[model samples]
Target: MVRKTLISNKAFGFLFLFIFLLLPSFISAQTQEYKDYTVEKGDTLWDISQKELNDYFLWPKIWKENPEIKNPDRIYPKQKIRIPLYLLQKEIPETKPKPELETKPEIVKEKPVEKIIEPVKKEYLVNKDILIAIGYIADSVHSVGKITDSPVDRTILGKDDYAYIKTDNPVKIGEKFYIIRSVEKVIHPESGRKLGYLIEILGIAEVVNQENDDVKTIITDSYDEIPTGSLLDNFYEIEPPLAFENPRKPDINGYIVATRQLHIINGTWDIVYIDKGKKDGLQVGDILAPTLQSKHKIINGLIQLINLRESTSTAIVRKCNNSITKGDGITSVK
Candidate 1:
């Protein structure tokens, strides 16, 4: 009975020792599956989350993986840390992330990962209100209505004046038309090519009375003189939703064709028209650098494209080194 008891005690001791010896190796083997990282100077969990996953909000998940990190905010240099790949599948924006782990973790035998792609974002430049108000160049003018005559026999129209309008198209009672006039025909200075007519927005008119094709409209607002022979177009007020500031450098070039105020010399806050436009990979919010040809390229100022057409763009001078003119050479810039 004594020998049997002694044999039983020996077997139990061996079993306990075996488990104790294998425990550390089993834990280490499991940990080895994940890549290891050592904390460095100026390292914060918040920064780590963004640097690793492109999301600063995921710091708590990273902290949960590192149980030894008693205080997430109090990490030290050379401190060994385990920042495991927590999610098998994650949706994140495609960004260049700098991971503390120098190498890509070969953490196979785990759940598979799925990465989703999202659209890239752009920088906002100007107010849409100001953008829509800026005049743009067009190849042709299509007027839905025309100002045939005015009440009280007024030759020159101003604000709050009644005008008789006629259109072949259907006109509603509340429909609005923009009183615009062809100010001048734009001719390319260098090439001597006829670009288009510059349609100036004089005022806004709203239809109040309509009898068959004869429509009566009241000039709601006027910026310039609205003559009797002025043309009426559909009211345009929407700006581009994707119009953003240009972040890329100059790859395409164009020339200034006209100015918004018809100024011979344009300065800050002046809107100018450019020859390069949407067809030339130009878009709203693109920054253009106006340069002067000399012994060296002279950068006069910068312009931000507020409107883009097929072959023309309207840009507001954001910066003015000297003065931008009608024929200044332009190149796209950040």
Candidate 2:
């Protein structure tokens, strides 16, 4: 009896040791696996979760893992996302077999259902406001000229009218140019540096003939009077209208530098130029809030970016509670 008891005790000790040794491997095997997924254009967090994890509601799980994603609705292409192994290995449950029917019932007539079609809404990046904004920016000209002569000494030139301009630079016949008048000098609000001269486009003209220092041009289009000492620059083409995408706000803050309207106060649908642009990571359709600085920050309006340049951008006011004007601070939309 003593020998049997000893053998039993030895077996129990060996069993406990085996379980202790295999416990770590079992826990390690139960741990979740991870995989990386590269984001593509037009991909959204919800869509990605649905496609990769087979669960669209798990988008928050993805966002939790990637704290860099500040906005779940505004993710850019080429971003990397981590996916879990359980989702990838999930299996569909098998359907149970249906019981056989006992007997066939009488046939019944069914009503036809009506199909309803919904109209698709079209989205646009460039609208009338955007075009006006572009025109305002294009009004600034570098090359200059002066009206030398016109038929009957006409001070104002219109469409289909011929005017002779004197410029120091050579003019190529058949080239088109814009006739503009200097309006004001734009200076950087912060640095006090002279940015450039803002001008008003008076008319468009095509060079019909070129003399030694005189270029005869026929006005093709005119918005205002084209008089003597009017500046000239190469014609600028307006970019084609584009559709607006889901835009992400820029990380930097700026302020309104100029407005297309001549008035001091601006409201809804007005085009305004901001000091930030592509260099600041601003994109078309990105919305910004305009705030007035006094004792405290007062939000006055919302503006959506429609056109972008190197150091500046054009935005159209979408909504306004108070009048917006130059010097108002602008920041990324929250």
Q: Which candidate has the highest lDDT of all?
A: 1
Task: Name the runs in model 2 displaced over 4 angstroms.
Answer: 1-124, 127-141, 209-214, 262-269
Question: TM-score winner among the candidates?
Answer: 1
Tens digit per residue, CA lDDT, model 1, 1-334: 9999999999999999999999999998687665566777867665676676665445666666777765454678898766664431266446785677577778679787898886653222444434444556778886877888997898899889999987758888989988777767888868989899777677789999977666789988776677898888888676444432124454777788887643211111477888887788876656678887555778886776767788888887756677677877887553
Runs off by more than 4 Å, candidate 1: 1-133, 212-214, 240-246, 262-268, 293-295
Model 2 Cα lDDT, one tens digit per residue, 1-334: 9999999999999999999999998887666466778999867665797788875445666766776765554577888877766566667565797898789889989898898987643334543323532344432467656677786688767778999887656778887887777667767666776655655667788889876666788988766656766778667776634444345556568878876552111212366777887887777778788888656878786787777777787776656677787788897666
Q: List the residue pairs that clash in candidate 2.
A: none
lDDT scores of the candidates, listed in order? 0.71, 0.69
Cα lDDT for residue 170, candidate 2 = 75
